[model samples]
Target: MEVGVWWTRFRAVLAFSDAVVVLGAAACVPLLGGARDPWPVLLAAAAAWWVALGVGGSRDQRYLGVGQEEYKRLVSVTVHLIGVVALVALLLRTDAPRPYLTTAAPVGAAALLLTRWGWRQWLHARRRHDPTWSHRVLLVGNGATVDHLSRQLASRAHLGYHVVCTWEVTSAHEVDIAETARALVRLARRNEADVIAVTTSDALSSELLRRLGWLLEGTGLQLVVVPGLLAVAGPRVHTRPIAGLHLLCIEEPTFTGATRVAKRVFDVAAAGAALVALSPALLAIALAVRTTSPGPVFYSQTRIGKHGRPFRMVKFRTMSTDADHRRAELLTANELDGPMFKMRDDPRVTPVGRWLRRYSLDELPQLFNVLLGRMSLVGPRPPLPDEVRRYAKDTRRRLLVTPGLTGLWQISGRSNLSWSDGVALDLQYVENWSFTTDLVILWKTARVVVAGTGAY
Candidate 1:
């Protein structure tokens, strides 16, 4: 199962799914008592929608497996299709069925998106166990750049990239661009690679990159140029071609703005609603903890928040009353790397406490922290004061925003993550924070909690 062949099949499936959605929407129009000859109208609408999707690049392979670009293109195409329908009706001056058009557009778009999401889930699941679904990549660049890019890609296996081999250029000046391109082609062919990824290097000039692209032309292998910049989100990075050079302009991350305000508003509304809606469950958890453990129902610990401020983060007590006193005794048995302490089977944890921690029910009390503006619904995990004290200068940037009840680290692996990995994820979130990213994290958090992985 070569990646190229698999991708072609995947694309065909997507096309079929889109066609089915269009047909279903058309079928709905006749059922809704639209025009006498609904077939013509339905066909016209379907054709227009398909054309719109093509024009908007909704089916672009580059955006298929990763990022929100695919979703954005779908939304854009759907909107354009609706507008086209309205304009045509206005110009033709005919009795158009407004209800049918409105209903079909939304329904079709939703179905298409849902279908794509389902496929993505299936693909990701397959990738978890088998690398066959992933593109075999031939990496070429300077040593440092290649290693960095390889690690980044390897960490995100869900993106479907497997680095098969790497060619390290000690000095780009020593090799000619034409020769390098030939070498790359040979390596790709030898490794049966589906993609050739060249990381940005100081030695390689833009002209050389262009030459490589020209060499890869009509070769069936995709050539991807990885920019040197790290931790930059797509929205912040804009490509501008000026003077025959592709310049990537990166924007600084926003800390305060209308977007930030919207995030705050969402956090407040969601946290408040959850507190009210889950009050019964919260009460039950409190009672369970109180009856099962010889400790207070709630545990409040000093955690570092935004700008190094300290706040009392509350959680349902998940350990015995003497847990803190016994911390020194278990220090030698700490299972987690870095400053945080974790043990899969700690003697201090009561049976009920273990269950609460597993599903993150213990952290439900943090809705109060979010409501009080001491935390957010999505951000970096709140670090204990002792953990914060061990932070390096670069890690301190995570404090620029409020801590979160759930975040990249939480949804990623929770206690299973190494300290450095957790910090890397947190820093990535801090540097590329967006409302969309928050929504994705929150959605993933639900799944992670349900699975109860990496929870201690």
Candidate 2:
């Protein structure tokens, strides 16, 4: 907590929130004082609040720049402190000031949440403007996993992790750590990396992974595992401690029960609402497509849907009429692969098509797909039949769920990622399907769409 690496931006958020709590507590002392004298009690409560935050890992630098993990811990600590005060008041049998206590509870909670949001705003601004503050990371993994993870980390600037260099091991397959620890130490020094990420897969020796943990304990460098290199999503994998050994269990991707119902509800509500709200914009896009070129307003293509069924995915026509017929000729200039073609500066695209693709307005009609139950509001990207043939056995699992208008692939660089990456992302999405991850992906999709990056 004191010495390890934390995303500096995250640290700033925690620091600001902590300050708010302290200041709020101080402000309440005057109004909340009991008639007899409440100075001691107030001081003690304030002290307990700070101490609990410390014990809860709320101040740990490791969590500073990461995602919701830090906020979860902060909430946990805050709730415990509030509970302690509630219990003490109940036991003492003294009438506490109801107004101050009641007001403070809600106010403090609101402040905590609001401060985190505000801090995030500031952090994002800093990331855009400040170059020196980039997160310095030392990636450690064997062959393929290392390369994949590095690229993933490199592209997500908002996540703030910068891959300075890597400790190249045998690969994600062989986890022999006999020489891995020494290797990590050398790499960390060479790269001046602040953190060490171990992405070795489960096929390797677990003991070696554990020993690498020991090797890192005294190094003052942060240690994090990729959790699942061959798989995706943290929730799909769980750890259990039985008989002094830690066993990792990875469950299959199956959204059922209440989860499935909630997803359907969200999809319908989102898609239904979006279609109704965007009707004017949709009509405008159609008119633009019709007026911009001599072609139909809508472009429809056969894409593989859930369980390997074919469905017509519709978009506003962005390319020339001959674009589809001449796809083969354009494959030579393909910038993206894996059974599909993506040309960065496709000569086939009409000027309007290029602009339409930029902001993803062309995909707005997919709301109809989502409404028809042929696709989801969020899931894996619907692929072409030719693309489906190339999927490895594990990658085929992505078809279990409804296809998506904007998926992990769409949210993360879309046409920019490589062939192997497309498969990995699909498998990861299938394996780690969760309502929360889906929400995050949707939120990220907004940013990617606005940036219009990798659109071609």
Of the candidates shown, which would achieve the greatest lDDT relative to the real structure?
1
Q: What is the lDDT of residue 451 in candidate 2?
A: 89
- Candidate 1 lDDT, tens digit per residue, 325-403? 9998998898877888888889999999899999999999999999999999999988888888888899999999999
For residue 311, model 1's alpha carbon misses the true position, in angstroms, by 1.2
- Report how far off residue 201 is in candidate 1 (Å): 2.2
Model 2, range 1-456, lDDT digits (tens) per residue?
122223554665576567667557545646564233366755565566666777888767655545787678767877776677677778898557343356555566567666766666666666555534556678866668888888666666556677888766664454446676777777787777767777755544677667767877876677777766355456667789999987887777775778978998899999999998989999888888899899899989999998999999998899999987899887788776566777787888888888989899888999898888889988888888888898778778888888898888887668888877876787778777888888989888998999889886
Candidate 2 ranges beyond 4 A from true positions: 1-13, 21-52, 81-111, 117-230, 390-392
Clash tally, candidates in order: 0, 4
Evaluate all candidate structures by whole-model CA lDDT and list the values in order.
0.86, 0.74
RMSD of each: 1.8, 5.1
List of clashing residue pairs for candidate 2: 6-61, 10-64, 142-171, 143-171
> How far out, in Å, is residue 210 in model 1?
2.4
